[model samples]
Structure formats: C-alpha cells, structure tokens
Target: MPLFEYRCMKCNHDFEELVAATGRTKVVCPNCGATSVEKLHSVFAARADASPIPVPAGGGCGRCGDPAGPCGM
Candidate 1:
C-alpha cells in the first residue's frame, strides 16, 4: 500500500490516505464527503530505515554547489 495525499476542492482540507494503487483513483474527501478531491503528487526525501539523511547547513547545495538559488539547489 502506498500513502497518497489528497486535497478537497470543496473544503480545502488536506489529508493522507493509505490505499491500494487500484483504489487510489476512487478516493473521495473524508471531511466534506465530496468527490472533488484531487490526488497530489508528493515529494519525499530519501531515508535510511527511520533516519533522515542530514542536509548540509549554510544554504549550500551539498549535491551540486554553484551559488545557491532560492530552492537551495
């Protein structure tokens, strides 16, 4: 099962759901019971086990440094 993020267009409520991939498209807003909920594409940082990888401080792009931009990349 994959966790999916959903946003309600009617109530503007955000929530997460754990559902089978086949059922993902059938999910509706739980708060407002509306079918106008949209599945959101989420960005997740890679993790090792339960530990989060440390990011270098000082606003530098640890991956590719060429003067940091607004996105820190």
Candidate 2:
C-alpha cells in the first residue's frame, strides 16, 4: 500500500490515507464528510549511507581503459 495525501475542498481539511494503488480516487473528507476531495502529490524521503562511485575525469574506465566506461557501468 502507498500513502496518499488529500485535501477537502468543502472543509479545507488536509489528511493522509494508506490506500491501494488501484483504489478509487473518490475520498471522503473526515471533517465534513464531503466527497469533494482532491488527491495531492505526496513527497517521500530517502537515505543513502554509501558514497557515490566517482567517474574518471578522462571520460573512460580508469582501470580497463574502455572508452564507454565498462558498458556505461
């Protein structure tokens, strides 16, 4: 399941719901019980503990000297 954000037009309420991806877009407002709700784009967070592999400045594989950089890595 993915979390979706919604805003109620009638009551101007904002909330988030855990819903199925194929579920209906028609959501009821919890504050006023209004069906006039607009689905919102949700933001997500990600974390990376590992550093990115550095690309050679010469534009090629530093170790094997492949011009395309090891099949573009």
Candidate 3:
C-alpha cells in the first residue's frame, strides 16, 4: 500500500491515507469525519544517515542570516 496526502474540503483538515491504487477513490477525513476530501501532492522525507545535506551556493543559511550557522552555506 502507498501512503498519500489528502485535505478535507468540509473541515479543511489535512491527513494521510494508505491507498490501494491510484484512481478516483473515496477518502474520509479522520478529523472531521467528512467524505468530501481532495488529494494533495505528497512531500516525502528522506533520512540522511551521517550524510551532509547540500546547501545552495551563496544563499546564506535559510533561517538565520549567518553563513556559519547550523545551516552552513
């Protein structure tokens, strides 16, 4: 089963669902118990075990303006 993201139109709640296959499938919102929901573009996260995350060139730390911050530029 593949996990997919969805947003409830009735209550405006966002959730994830384990879908069988890609198609017009009915999904219920767990928060609002509404059947009216819309599929959303899922953003997946990856585990970088010991590997350094690449930082864009010249674009100082995204958070603090310091270049030598935790998010090294």
Pick by lDDT: which candidate is best?
3
Candidate 1 residues lying further than 4 Å off, grouped into runs, are 23-25, 43-73
Model 2: weakest 10-residue lDDT segment is: 43-52
Candidate lDDT values, in order: 0.65, 0.71, 0.72
Tens digits of per-residue lDDT, candidate 2, 1-73, equal 7677889999889988777678566679989999988878553321122434345887766656777774433
Candidate 1, residue 30: Cα displacement in angstroms equals: 1.2
Residue-by-residue lDDT tens digits, candidate 3, 33-65: 899888885534222334554555775564566
Tell me the spans in candidate 2 whose CA falls farther than 4 Å from its real position: 45-73
**Per-candidate count of clashing residue pairs (backbone under 3 Å):** 0, 0, 0
Better model by lDDT: candidate 1 vs candidate 3: 3
Tell me how far candidate 1 lies from the true structure as C-alpha RMSD in angstroms. Answer: 7.6
Candidate 1 clashing pairs, residues 3+ apart or interchain: none
Listed in order, each prediction's TM-score against the native is 0.51, 0.53, 0.51
What is every candidate's alpha-carbon RMSD to the true fold?
7.6, 6.6, 7.9
Clashing pairs in 2: none
Consecutive 10-residue window with the lowest summed lDDT within model 1: 41-50
Q: Which whole-number lDDT from 0 to 100 does residue 48 have in model 2? A: 25
lDDT of 3 at 7: 94
Question: Which pairs clash (backbone N, Cα, C closer than 3 Å) in model 3?
Answer: none
